[model samples]
Target: YEPSEDALQVEVDTKTIPHTEFLTYVFTDLSSTGATVALDWAKKQIPFKIEFDVSAIVLADIRQKLQGEAGFQRQNWEQAATFAMNNGGDLQEALGWINNAIEGQFFSSKTFNNMAVKAQILQKLGQKDKVLAMVPEMAGMANTNEMNNLGYMLVNMGENDLALKYFKINAKNNPANANVFDSLGEAYKIMGDRKNAIKNLKKSLSLNPPAGVKANSERLLAELGVVI
Candidate 1:
């Protein structure tokens, strides 16, 4: 029979069959239809196993390890933790599993989704305060651009003090980034702090920021009545 589109190789070896078993094995390049034909003719499935070298017990052990829930837990720690948290299971155990997976040789479970799983577990355990305490970790995990743009957003919303709060935090966290100083300068300029604005703007310019940032800071400084 013609092989299906998904077939890599299809062959029927008659020499492999037992002569005394009164069985004529017809291996077809069939998928579901082949199974149906085999069931109708042979009353049992002739499994498609390529390994003639390995013992059946070895194959069985490998199959069990692969298809078992232990295999799922080993590979899918994130998914398993998420499921445990969602189902209101033993959250501490789930948290342990997640943390171990993160710290272990598997993958990066310190990310947002895995952290969200920890939050969900904390919420489930009635430690709402601890869940709120994840805010610091979340803030620490915030990227530089995230902090800068958030401060700019607050400034646009007419919350200059709040913008300064985030900008100062950004500056403290990333003192070396020229764009952070530039953003802080803009926020200070919006708040009418011409002195500090010029200070940070000059700092940004001195640090050699992006192409337009120096010119933007210089223009803002000029608009703030700074001579140069």
Candidate 2:
């Protein structure tokens, strides 16, 4: 297989070890216990200045295997996160590791997709506050249904602080979307923020909402004792 140009660079043995012996060392150390052994081997193999493409191939394979392992030990959380983000490995364990990655810069240069993966894991863990905290300022994450679902879930969980923040962000990001406005109105109503609730509900009605949205908004406006 071709060595990818995107190769990992680390430290290697100044004393030349034979390739067969290195492979033997790896399998003997890591195969059944999880991949940190190969990862350790690969880290030790990364020379300050790489001189051979053949070595890059082995290093890439070692990192790939390490990145794909599902080990859940707190010490292994970083690797678990890489596997979870890239390979759908373990949502629960990924949360712990991603938080660690964010804190420790383990992800090289974390992408918006990596942050989105964190949000996804938090949502799966039913952590409304954390997911809501993660959504704003997360670039390219504008799935309307996902926002509504998260907002409603927060509301159901009585996390009004997070729900209001989430729906307000959804409304701001999706100004003309009546469903977003309706969700915002419900959050405000739940907060006893009657004035904003009635205003958003009216805006939702005027935006030519989907079939059921108009009725829901009007009912909420009435419940807020506002004439709409």
- The Cα local distance difference test for each model comes to 0.66, 0.64
Question: What residue runs in model 1 are displaced by over 4 Å at the alpha carbon?
Answer: 1-138
lDDT of 1 at 226: 84
Backbone clashes in model 1, listed as residue pairs: none
The local lDDT score (0 to 100) that residue 39 gets in candidate 1 is 16
Specify the poorest-scoring 10-residue window by lDDT in model 2.
31-40
Candidate 2 residue runs with Cα over 4 Å from true position: 1-140
Model 1 lowest lDDT segment of ten = 32-41
How many residue pairs in model 1 have overlapping backbones?
0
Which candidate number maximizes TM-score?
2
Model 1 residue 104 lDDT score: 66
